[model samples]
Target: MASVDLGKVLDKAWADKPLAEVLAAPVSALKGVSDRDGELLDEAFGVKTVADLADLKYVRWAQALAALDAAK
Candidate 1:
């Protein structure tokens, strides 16, 4: 079987433009996320994929929301 194309797996996610939504993708699927970032995220956040990202029940959403509000 061909290896999964994780990069292609989440192309639609980038277009959606929501961190909560995009976080559901494989961490490897993101732009600019070097393997180093992947390792760090997994270790620090238990975030191996986008679903983990969306599930972050902490300060991220609040921070993003604050940034968005500040931009207004």
Candidate 2:
């Protein structure tokens, strides 16, 4: 299993949470993401949680594109 230091990517309040909890947390729980940004994402894409954002089709497509570009 891979271990990551959540503190670096998550807000202080969320840093020590379990992976499931972290994934279920609001997008704003992520470091540097504000409540307004979360609301915008929600409004634009119906993304509310970290998992929702990760599962968004646009996000997946962008990641695939980035990976393909990196591989080229």
Off by over 4 Å in 1: 1-25
Instruction: Give candidate 1's whole-model lDDT.
Output: 0.69
TM-score (C-alpha) between model 2 and the true structure:
0.91
Native-to-model Cα distance after best TM-score fit, residue 49 in candidate 1, in Å: 0.6
What lDDT does model 2 reach?
Answer: 0.96
**Alpha-carbon RMSD, each predicted model:** 9.6, 1.5
Model 2 Cα lDDT, one tens digit per residue, 1-72: 678789899999999999999899999999999999999999999999999999999999999999899999
TM-score to native of every candidate shown: 0.49, 0.91
Candidate 2, residue 23: CA error in Å?
0.9
lDDT score of residue 61 within candidate 1 = 79
| Best lDDT among the predictions, by candidate number | 2
> Where does the lowest 10-residue lDDT sum fall in candidate 1?
4-13
Instruction: State the lDDT of candidate 1 residue by residue for 46-65, as single tens digits.
Output: 88886775567765878789
